[model samples]
Target: MMGQPPYSRTTIDELLRLIERAGLFERQPMVERKIMHYSSLQTILLVGEGNFSFSSALATAFESAENIVASSIDSEDKVLRVYNTARSSIENLESRKALVLYEVDATRLHEIEELSTRIFDRVVFNLPHAGYFPGGECSKEAIKKNSELLSMFLESATKLLSLDGEIHVTNKVGPPYKKWNLEGAAENYGLYLKESVSFQKADYPGYMNKRGSGAKINRTFRLGECETYMFSAV
Candidate 1:
């Protein structure tokens, strides 16, 4: 049986916001940093972008997105229809010469001739979820399915990595997500966790976290506590 979809209940981010409003949530102080992990000097490939705003933001930050390739699993028509900001974001990337692709599946990236022939310094998948499935997002089946997606992605991504290249996945930290056990899954695919860092949305000025699937596909989600897991070939 299909499980309850995400956002059907109070999300952790929403709960945290309520706590903050009540003067009880201890929030971490935001730190200012000059250098972030991503750079225009390195070849970057972004997969599963809902609306491509994140890609556009990166391009703006670097002042050039020539070294970046952004892709979405959804078709151009769907993206253009679902995301109100999609047109402008795609235009921004294209204007900056950033390659924008549609119908790119993260799990089978190695099969794409366009991506297979090239190598990238960084292959990024931000907040990857397998979407709604049987038993829902919190079920063990959901965790296993999501883990399989990550493992397959890691296997495929390894083929397109340059020497010393890395694969990055930023996801919410807790509950069924934590149960995904991505670090362990990465090891099965010959990847080792290089580093895990807190994911601060403020780091990317125009980036917004969208549901990316189902009825809430066009809406943004509350990102409570998230982390970026960096992995490289072992």
Candidate 2:
């Protein structure tokens, strides 16, 4: 469920190297991977997964996917077709007994029969954005659509969240993302920002951030200054 500007690149490291070579950005030291915040014992729900790599990474880290539930907005068939590695990821999740759902809209989590009565300790949505549009990522239309999606998702997620659980949304830190003003949107849903933490891809060993849309749906995107914004219900 992440939306990103059209990029044909393969990996963040490759893109960063290109930037450094062009002298646009100075090379910085590599970030050490942080320990994952989600625990294996916790009931976790991940939404809007592009290729389910994040879920697969978690399952591998935990040595089991028994406590995890992963979902996608696209149909299972569509996911398999678009993402080159999806079949194996889904297989891994399934083999580990992780609940895998398809076409589960982010704005209607509670309405799903399988999810209606469940509560999760950690609910994560990574790189949420509206699908590609004509005017590109910075267009007013893009921001508005993405903001509305965030707002509705928060409202829905609040209903399914455990009393002491957290809702996590990871996104790029600046520019068009900042314009979305997630803090303001959370307040509208009676949720408050608890903290924001740096999002390092290395933290999730097998996780690959996909463009998640358009012709390059299978391609990875550059993650610049991304942070995981954790929110709690008021």
Candidate 3:
């Protein structure tokens, strides 16, 4: 049977507002755009885009990608948010670009391959933390689930990547960092980590509301860690 949806109306609405107000909407676009210029990839795939915010950034970055496919799982209220965000991004691009968006379990490779129809030059995984859900609970079960999901996501993504394609992943490693090591997990999926970059607290704009928030911060701090990794296909 299908599992219950991941989000609710109130939670979805609140997250959306926070994302917009926090300027994450713009941040995602900027990140993708920069990567586009830096990597010079011809095609890209995005997995687990909860609301197309990051996808929008990618769209702006690769205006003429050979192919672009994005996927997310939408069961309950998450469906509303995902659809709305994706639609908004699509409208913003306003170009008949070869972009395909799917509402599917991001961990499923067959589904992704079906939609993409070919290997991609770039694959991205920007997943949610274990405790980001409404229940606000994190357990071994949850971590294991996320790990398995990520493993499958990588397996399929690699299979669909071009010979020299690369996979990019971003995740938050919070306090008591004893749960799951994403870097280790990626290796389990047969991906070799090539490079890792961290964005310091000073590097990004302050957390939306702050006393001296003018421009986005570009320095590191005790909290707020952003990690990016480039992995080669095996």
Candidate 4:
């Protein structure tokens, strides 16, 4: 999930625009729609959904799929708007299956276990709003804390997944860095970094400008390379 600070309005807006342009907004929705159309699955869980914008888009795209559950944890009032919009869209579905929505902390596995009674075939953490917020520190302590929080996120997510299920994650690779080091933390939690999809400069929208240039650049790029990672259970 994207764990940036939630207070950077410019950064958040730009990231959402970039996400829309990159087709990520539709990618998972289409996958869920197709899977439900041709296969059989009872439930799906979306964790750390932030504003639930992506969840709303997925609901619209997969309206025909039954028993789909989407959720998020945003104490902010804006999250309610997102929930209402998605809930309204789901009312048009031909099937009468319910889409559960809740406001709960993701780091607490006991809360999740209490909220959701079933294992999910698909679990998603698009991006979280923790590390990159306005008050968040980029110091050594903050990075270490962020890493630990990310590890906890994985641990809780694993508990919600089916044995053969997959977890799809996306994150910006460090600038000027070519490889991501997932050896220590990921291995400690029985999770593996699967593969990364690289996008060229043209593939990302409004990311050409350097940082602090008044342009929004959430995904960092150096030497003309930018990417996001996908992880799964070992």
By TM-score, who's the top model here?
2
TM-score of every prediction relative to native: 0.83, 0.84, 0.63, 0.58
Name the top lDDT candidate: 2
Residue-level lDDT of model 2, residues 110-181, one tens digit each, is 999999988888889999977998899899999999999999999999888988999999999889899987
- The C-alpha RMSD in Å for every predicted model, in order, reads 21.2, 19.7, 17.8, 18.1
Q: What tens digits encode model 4's per-residue C-alpha lDDT throughout 88-144?
A: 433432234545455666666445655455676666654332444353345555565
Please report, as a residue range, the 10-residue window in candidate 3 with the lowest summed lDDT: 205-214
Sliding window of 10 residues with minimal summed lDDT for model 4: 205-214
* Model 2, residue 188: C-alpha shift (Å): 1.1
Q: Please list the residue runs of candidate 3 whose C-alpha ends up more than 4 Å from where it truly belongs after superposition.
A: 1-41, 75-86, 93-96, 129-138, 174-178, 199-223
Ranking the candidates on lDDT from highest down gives: 2, 1, 3, 4
Comparing 3 with 4 on lDDT, the higher-scoring candidate is 3
Query: What digit string (tens of lDDT, one per residue) describes model 1 on residues 1-234?
Result: 998776735686788789899859876643322237987678899999989988888988877788899999999999999999999999999999999999999999989878988999999999998887757898887888898888888888988999899999999998979888889888987888999999998888888888888888889989999999999984
lDDT of 2 at 13: 74
Please give the TM-score that candidate 3 achieves against the real structure: 0.63
Which portions of model 2 show Cα errors greater than 4 Å?
Answer: 1-35
Off by over 4 Å in 4: 1-32, 35-42, 65-67, 76-78, 81-98, 113-116, 131-137, 175-183, 198-228
Cα-based lDDT for every prediction: 0.88, 0.89, 0.56, 0.51
In candidate 1, which residue ranges exceed 4 Å CA deviation? 1-35
